[model samples]
Target: MKKTLLALLFGSSLVLAACGDNASDEASDANNPQDAAESAAGTEIEPEKIVNQKCSSCHGGDLSGGMGPALKNIGSQLSEDEILSVIQNGKGAMPKNIIEGDEAEAVAEWLAEKK
Candidate 1:
């Protein structure tokens, strides 16, 4: 069940990223300031640091699996949007509505490259 959930989440992220990317060209100018700023910051936010500061308590440093599941290959498992959703809404055993807006998005972008 755990692996299944992870797979589902991963697939969702990929689908979401692809969908979002397809629409990016049309929404470039429509992006809010926060989106623009996050885009300016570039992709990937250093998972090690973000994990230590915001997620280690539950997810652990190696992200091999803990209160949360093994996350080492999450980059390959999930897409940017799915990652963002997890950060924003969390998942079973994980709290929701914690990280918000850009922080969530930045972490997502970072995590997407983890694999």
Candidate 2:
């Protein structure tokens, strides 16, 4: 009887462990930024698209500078945090709060990786 009880308990514990693993996997999927963005936008959010839509007018189509300063090598000129701050808050002739939230974060991350 004791052996049967032990087997049952062990089986229950294994089932519980499997359940926990599945829950964690679901939670991680939910937390994925790209997945969240795609759900919200009904499509994937491309960082380059955001840049082109919002920045291309002044920065030029290729980010090689036009009315705004060149951004082709901005990654070497500024840290990611600095770039994010400048993007969020604006600097010089740039208007403030041009981008915000996740889109801003994605753009900043993309630009910071240009180097």
Which of the numbered candidates is closest to the native, going by highest lDDT? Answer: 2
Cα lDDT tens digits for candidate 2, 1-115 = 9999999997776445322343554576688977656666656558898788678767888999986899998999988889999987788867666778787888888899988
Query: Could you estimate the TM-score for every candidate?
Result: 0.56, 0.63
Give the range of the ten consecutive residues with the poorest summed lDDT in model 2: 14-23
Candidate 1 regions with alpha-carbon error over 4 angstroms: 1-47
Using TM-score as the measure, which candidate wins? Answer: 2
Model 2 residue 107 CA deviation in Å? 0.5
List lDDT for all candidates, in order: 0.68, 0.77
Q: State the local distance difference test value for candidate 1.
A: 0.68
